[model samples]
Target: MSTHDTRNTRGRGATHMENGSITQHENHTRMREMTQRNQDMERMKEEVIRHVQSRLNEVLERALTDSLQSLSTHTQTHTDKTESTNNRHKLEEGKVFIARCSLLDELFEISHIRTIYHMFIAALFLFIMSTLAVDYIDQGRLVLDFDLFYYAFGQLGTVVWAWTLMLSYTLLGPYHVLRVWGEQALRSRWRTCVCALTLCAAQTSMLGIFPVCVVLHYQLPPASRFIIILEQIRLVMKSYSFIRETVPAVLKNTTQKDKSQRYPSLSSYLYFLFCPTLIYREVYPRNPSIRWKYVGMNFLRILASLFYLYFILVRLCIPVFRNNSHQLFSSRSLILMLFHAAFPGMLILMLGFYAFLHCWLNAFAEMLRFADRMFYKDWWNSTSFANYYRTWNIVVHDWLYYYGYRDFLLLSGYKLRSMATLCVFAVSAFVHEYAFTMGFGFFYPVMFCTFAGIGVVFNFAMNDSRKSPVWNIIMWVCLFIGQGIHVCLYCLEWYAQIHCPRTGTSFWELVTPRSWTCNYQ
Candidate 1:
């Protein structure tokens, strides 16, 4: 029984062992497959990393190349341009844009500005029609009387004579005296000073004393006297400019003159007297041809402006002033008169600026073939009183700056800019006041106060830095008010003279303003 049982147990154990061995083999095969799959995944990850890195490197290289190329192109362009500019400058080529025509000339080439010219013509026609209608309505018929103008401008021959006298002094005397002084000054410096002083005294007599005599002794009418006196002032200013400009050169070249140097030619002197410029250059750029058509047009503009002024005075000034003359004088009355005069005053200002500075100066310049025609800048567009003062009359400004201010600086050893400026202001104011006094035959200080007090205040207050349009409007308002004051006061005095004739020509009576005491009512 024991032998059978043992044999069965041994057989079962051997079968069980065989089954366990099969299970172990299957487990080993599955583990080996999983390890193989993990190794393959690792190899794929390495390949992906290498490929992405290579692509990034290519992008960086391309971006750097493009950036370099752009930088190179820009650098090369700038360098080429700079080199060309340098070469041109170094060569000092011909015709380097020395002179161009005025900015106004360019604008005139445009249609809009030309249209403005037509507008002016239209305005002139309107003025004519208005004057005719007004006169026809007022007097029940149109007389077309020009007698007032004729009477105002009566005796212009004395003006011509006074002008001739002033011109003779300027043309003939100054140069010779300068030459003699220059020759003598070569030996001694004090001699130069003495001779200069002596010349100054002689010039004062010729320019100042003689013209005053002509004005007083001849008893010139207001308009005729204005012509002479203004001419006198012009001559004095021009002569001073000439002497200041030329005397230094003469003195400097004295030794050079002894040793084959040249003196200023007579032709140059004559040209300087006639030329529009106050700062004289011996040889100025000239036009190729005289534009006679332009000259004729300018002259026509002058005549039109004169008629325009006449119409304004007759229609606006006479009506306003004549009606008001009978009113009792008071601050209220004067203020009302000023307000009424504003339009006519503005018209007069415009006519004065356009006629004298633009038309008259341009005509003379064209006829003389003077190339530099920058008589006035855009003064109407000025934003400040200082700017207006500077651009209002460039000719006069140049003279005063070169002669009065600059010369004063020199005489004062070049230290006082403010003092020099003040001196220039004083001279200008004095001359203006003198002209007014002589013309109106009264010593009213309106112009003097306006010029010295208000002008100075505005010059400092509304200075060059004021660039706003508001400031420009303010400047214009000030100009209108100032012009209004001038027209009202001067016209009052004019009527006052006719209404209140003085019994005696004593100093007090002649010098005092008749407008203050007149009872036209």
Candidate 2:
């Protein structure tokens, strides 16, 4: 039992020992793998954290750069604006200082420049005086003979004389005179001058051919039509009635110079309506530069005469005879034509005449007479466009400024200064129409009112300086064309209303076919 049992037990014991050793080795291998995996996971987590911190740093740097760049750009823009504003201020100050310096040095600086200036001024004075004196002599009917041909020839001679004097004074007279007298600023000033020249040139050319064209185109009549004479008389009577009614209304509103002052004449009323009140009140601060400007204006007087002569011959006398007519040199026909062109033309002509006379007298007084009273009380004393508007024909401007401009603004309850300007201009057009009705005995107020109303609206609506140049030119052209159309329409209406019996025969009806035309007699 001992030998057999011992042998079997030893074998079983060996087997059991081997099985236990194998199990122990397998367990050790599993523990090693699990520990290694955990260590690798911890290393991976650390690497991921480091990578995230690096990315955040990069983003932070980018954000800082963008914020700094934006701030710098803003700072630069502000600095530039400040610098530009400073420069503008400096320029304005410099101009004012220089002007003051010039005035201070005037007495000491009176050298050859001064002498030449004075001499040229004297020559201009003489030229203007001579032209005006000649005009007066002609107008006063001093010449004994009054034949039509002679009258025409004399007028032509007067025009030639005026032209000659103007050219001679401008070319041969002092050099300073040209500089002082002829220099003009503002785009509108030049445009107006060009338009005036165009008018004269065109009209003169047309007029020169009129007599020949008339004679060739139609047979002469023994007697002029009496119907036109009666029409004109009726028109005048109607116009007189309108004016009589209007004048009293105007008088009631106008403040008098004194309680004793009588009611104004038609001419005076015209002056009031057209002229600016601001001219009577000082607009600009007084300075030597301003004073010298008047002297220069005096020199320009001769040139103004040339303009006047051009208007009288080309605008008035010539246009009337452009087409062929049955009546040859008939006084009644001439009068009729004159009446047709009278209102607007007279308003324009009177303003020019007043300016011309003032300048002429101012020049003469400054050069030959050296009268202070003339400078103070004379017409050219208000030669500035603003002054001329206000003082010389103050009633017109006053009416515009007060009733037209101020009243409109107040009535409309507009607080903006810009709108106020529009209100005034619109009012001006209205009053101008009213005046026109008094002269024409028709409701031309609508046409003229619209024309002027547009101008007022435009002057206000398009107030930006950048847009002004083109707009101003357009306005001027429109005004010229509108007025021309108005004149033509009036003429056509007068003809149709008198001759045509049809309900749609009135000019307004012909154009728009209104019910009013059907009811008119």
Candidate 3:
């Protein structure tokens, strides 16, 4: 029995040992599974970190390349701009150099031309002086008032005895000289003739109004109260003719057409016009006088003056006769009369009848044709002061340039030259003032003289006025205000005088007391 019990105990012990082995195997399998899961998680985390690092590297690389490209483009653009600026500067310098070379070339040419120019100018001056002397000798005193002559011509016989001699000289003379001296072809000669004739015809049309007025004045009834009104109407027509006929001719091509079959109608007209004026070699007359061009320009200005004078006379007479009441009684009436009746009426007279309104209507007809200088490739275009003076009154400016400035420069020093310029301007201003006074009275002339003196002073004081826009505006404003005040004072006096004529005031009191020679009855 003891052996059997011992065997059972051994069996139990074996079973317990097997159970312990089985439990140990199960615990070892669970630990192995947990370790496999932890290892898998760690491997996944490492892969994620590596992938994130690779993406970050790619992004950084792209950012670096983009930044570099932008910097490169900016640098190239800036460099290109800098190079362009430098090139522009070089080009400007080159232009300056070329201009200097051109100036030297012009100086050499002038030196050669001066000998002839001076002698011719001297002759012209002598001729003028002689003419003046002869007039003084005949009349016992020089007829200083040029307006009298202008008026006589404008109001007397402007048509038949039209002074279009200058147009004849300029258009005809140049080609004549060229033909005689240059031995130009027959075709070229004809072309020149056409140009000359056309120009002359056009100029005559513009300037011929004064002569027409003169003729009309004789034809029309005289010594009547309406005589002034008739003259004014004729003057308006004269202005219209000037603009229509003269401006176009002056602005159009003054050259005759070549033998080429182009422009048939124009060519035919030019040919017809030029044939009569040509002097076929009778030793072509040499007119060294620059006065011809001056005369043509003067024609334009003179016609304008006459037309304007006519306008003033018309204004003075129209309201009195038309309404049977003084138009200046009400401010509205005065403004309407000046704007509608006076200014616009004058404009219409100048434009409607004037042939050249086709082109020059936009231009300053009252001023000078100096604006042509911007397009004119000549000596006068190169200077500031010359340009200004020329712009003021082109015909007169030309006269001063040839007669006054050049002669003064030749005879005396710089001081005299300056003085001569001032003198010329002053003389011109005086003439203008005196002429204006005949129609509008004396205030304008005084103001004009004062401002002209200022202009002369300013020309010397400031050589470069491009940077002086502000100062220029200020100066102009001051001059305008001063002139305005002066004009206002005269207007007041005139207004007072007009009322006095109705109020029984003494005529001497209404007028300047200084000029009155009163003989008390």
Please tell me which model should have the higher TM-score, number 1 or number 3. Answer: 1
Residue 316 miss distance in model 1 (angstroms) = 0.6
Which candidate tops lDDT?
1
Weakest ten-residue segment in model 3 by summed lDDT? 94-103
Query: Which one wins by lDDT: 1 or 3?
Result: 1
Scanning candidate 1 in windows of ten residues, the lowest lDDT window is 90-99
For model 3, state the Cα shift of residue 25 in Å. Answer: 91
lDDT for predicted candidate 2 compared with the true structure: 0.42
Best TM-score among the predictions, by candidate number: 1
Query: How well is each residue in 205-279 modelled by candidate 3, as lDDT tens digits?
Result: 543444344434454222221233333332323223322333233224234333332211222323322221111
Better of 1 and 2 by TM-score: 1
For residue 150, give model 2's deviation from the true position in Å.
15
Candidate 2, run of 10 with poorest lDDT = 94-103
Listed in order, each prediction's TM-score against the native is 0.77, 0.30, 0.30
Model 2 Cα lDDT, one tens digit per residue, 85-178: 7644542231111112222123224455567546645644654555566657868633322232243333333334433443333222222221
lDDT of 1 by residue, 1-521 (tens): 59999999999999999999999998899899999999988867766776698799999999988986787687988867776676545433211112445546655756678899789779878878887797889888866787768977988887877688788878888877877776566688788788778888888898889877887888877788888778777777666767766766775677455566566776898898888777666788888899999999989989888888888888789877877777666799999999988878998998898898888888898898888777778897899988898898888887776667666766776557788777888888988999988776667888999988888888888989999999989988888899999999998887887888888978898777777788867
In lDDT terms, how accurate is model 1? 0.80
